[model samples]
Target: MGLQNTKAPRAKRANIVMLGLDFAGKSTLLYQLRCKDVFLTVPTIGFNVDMIEMERDFTLTFWDVGGQEKMRQVWSNFLEDADGLLYVVDSSDKRRLEEARKEFELILKNESIKNVPVVVLANKQDLPGALNAEEITRRFKMKKYCSDRTWYVQPCCGITGEGLRVALERVATFARQYSRSKETFRNLKEMDTL
Candidate 1:
């Protein structure tokens, strides 16, 4: 018999939690990634979950949670199992920048997601007064607050899908790194016990 190869392709999975203030385009970004189309969405009172399959058997499942005042209290419930975070922001809502920054900082400080990778989507870049990625990063004080984790700010338009593909690519790369680090830590712990 001829030599045979029996290797199976590995599937990469990422459980990402998306969060932000109300009307920050979280739901719109979720649907846009899943359907590649703009969808009109009302304020999410609860949460929405969707799966997106990417090239090379990489699959991303996003949990888009409600950002209402009452809903924020339970956000930690979703954070416990997230492999990554996608923090959406209404770049055009200049007036709410401080509020968004406060919320973003709180999310990062959660113990469950202490070192998870974060992708801040500066959504609504097509609007008249939208902030750029640099501006969003500075306004949020990302470099100082996100020092313990891997993070990036991607300026995108949820309606037009601009910059979204690049954002996903960044998430995939970060997820891979995060997974490797976790695996390494587990291995080290097992060795310690041995």
Candidate 2:
């Protein structure tokens, strides 16, 4: 008998939208994931996209959107199709945490992204006086805003690459679970209407 060649199936893909205020290190984090090295990045005026192969046979496609005040109005436009979300925060900027929370609350109101998995990266954790993940979570009122979604708060240093992989691994797990549950719900709904 001839041997049959077999190949592993392609990894499932997840679209993850990354957003935060300008200077939150969103662009730096993206490049860090892509190259596993620190990268100097300018403020993104529009958007940047990159794909990272993650654990659990899943590939994460990240959409790093611009976060200037003028660009906040268009954030909802990218939420409709996102499988997951990464909301970066400048943990050292304690004075502006409230502003960040307001923006996060607004984004969570979009119905299209309801129940999407989210990872809040409290970046700049290595800096002196930076808030830890738990503090950031409380400050953001994560339980209040993310009550209907799967969410996590991770303390990380974008430049040092601390906690990045662990955070994304959690994201992959949640994304896969959420995707399956959503599919099952759709199937059940369709069957009911039949």
Candidate 3:
């Protein structure tokens, strides 16, 4: 049901990694998308990988890694070949907004992931005290971290799948744009011969 895209005749593929604190709903969201149902998800010990077809001829491959402090040390290892990022945050946990901010900054610092587009999912929105877009943006100071690539903050609930589909669509749009730019650059370089 995941990856093993051998049967697909022709399709563009993009790999995206999901990163966030433990219980931020990363695993749950992945399950909802792939299986169309939710389950009692345990803390992702290491990582989980799944591939799903997105808008037309595009396959989105997701790598969801554990969010524990120890796991973060190895997060950079999976950044290789990644085309985009899904950054989940427990918006309801106001007490740890600063902590999430710090972790996010660290992710931004990683040179490998710096250039990739990012979609920040402010998860657990169904809970009380969930930070809204304004609060989240301020806490994460997202604009400060953003660069040439596209970035956005979306409030969502992983359990009920609210805002999940729209988020994916936006990310897929960014991925498609990136693909076009890369192809254009290659073509331009090929035509540069004297």
Can you give the lDDT of residue 69 in candidate 2? 94
Candidate 2 C-alpha lDDT tens digits along 1-194:
99876987867888899999999999999898789899879999999999988766878889999999989999999898898999999999988888998999999988999999899999999999999988998999999889988899999989999999898788778877887888799999999999
Q: For residues 19-67, could you state the per-residue lDDT of candidate 1 as single tens digits?
A: 9999999999888888889998999998999988876688888899999
Candidates ranked by lDDT, best first?
1, 2, 3
Give lDDT tens digits, candidate 3, residues 1-194.
Answer: 68776675868888888999987889998898788788899999999999989857899999999999899899899888778888999999978778888988888888887678899999999998898877898788888888666898988888898888888888888777766776788899999963
- Model 1 misplacement above 4 A: 1-10
Cα lDDT computed for each candidate against the true fold: 0.91, 0.91, 0.86
Specify the highest-TM-score model's number: 1
Provide backbone clash counts, one per model: 0, 0, 0
| Candidate 1 vs 2: which has more TM-score | 1
TM-score of each: 0.92, 0.91, 0.89
Total colliding residue pairs, candidate 1: 0
Q: What C-alpha root-mean-square deviation, in Å, does candidate 2 show against the real structure?
A: 3.4
